[model samples]
Target: MDNIFKSAMRGALFFAAACLLLWGIVPEWKSVCAGLLLGAFASFMNALLLRRRVEIVGQAMANRGMRKMGLGLGSRIAMVLCVAMVAYKYPETFNLPATLAASMVMPFILLVSAFLHHKRH
Candidate 1:
């Protein structure tokens, strides 16, 4: 399996475990799980995006594929905007602070997950 994917899986597991610990066990953070889940999903999508980008750069596609590349990038941006809009419009369900916090920690999760996965092997 690709190292990046392994890392992403680890990150998702870690996030889920942490969320369960906090929301299931700790009453204070019970309401934040929804946002946390959204954030985790976003992070997973981001990882896939990164992997695709790596593949694109790795292949060194010619001008013909550049349009597809641009479209992909545009779609990613749209996803980001949608996430923001959803969280903003539905704060009760999404929890702004928690969602933002999750968004911020996504990259960190990716890195830590990758590192731990690498270390285990």
Candidate 2:
């Protein structure tokens, strides 16, 4: 699982870097690229947060330390909401549709990473 997450994160980071490069080279599509960059960044942070929470849950379960612990969905939602708000606030600088679409990309990244990892191993 950790290896899969790391692979997905590397893919996401590469994507974000590409977006940044596009933003620099293409002035006309700056808004769209900026949106993609922000969304990808947010998605990365959310994944990291989720990974940490899952690790914590696993540790707790192993130790029988807690009865119930949420996976921090509320915080993740808040982070996404914040990204949406930022895109909304800067309509000229960020495309909302692109931002929203990009934000949902991490799960797919994770899926593909896992698939490739499984195939390789």
Candidate 3:
């Protein structure tokens, strides 16, 4: 799991940097690139939040502690909502559709990493 997370994080960061480069190189596509950058950042954060929550839950379960646990779905949703709101608020600065699409990139990266890890092991 940690390996998956680390690889995903690296991929996400690389993606975000690429988007930033594109934004600088193409002034006409600034909105799209900015939106993608924002979404990629949010996606990375969402993955980190989920990973931390999972670790906490695993620790609690191992210790036999009876505490309610959740995967922080609400927080992740809220984070996405905030991104959407930002895009909506500044349509010229960010493309809404691109932002939404980029927001899902991290999960795909993580999935690919998991598949590769499974095949290797």
TM-score of each: 0.71, 0.93, 0.92
Candidate 2 ranges with C-alpha deviation above 4 Å:
68-71
Q: Write the residue-wise lDDT of candidate 1 on 3-121 in tens digits.
A: 75776677677877888777777766665787777666666676677678777766666534553344666666566666667788887777666766665566786677677777898
| Off by more than 4 A, model 1 | 61-68, 114-121
Among the numbered candidates, top lDDT falls to 2
Model 2: colliding residue pairs: none
Worst 10 residues of 2 by lDDT: 66-75
Q: How far is candidate 2 from the true structure (C-alpha RMSD, Å)?
A: 1.4
Preferred candidate (TM-score higher): 1 or 3: 3
**Which of 1 and 2 is the better model by TM-score?**
2
Give the poorly placed runs of model 3, Cα more than 4 Å off: 69-71
Worst 10 residues of 3 by lDDT: 63-72
Separate clash counts for every candidate: 0, 0, 0
Q: Quantify all predictions' global Cα lDDT against the true fold.
A: 0.69, 0.90, 0.90
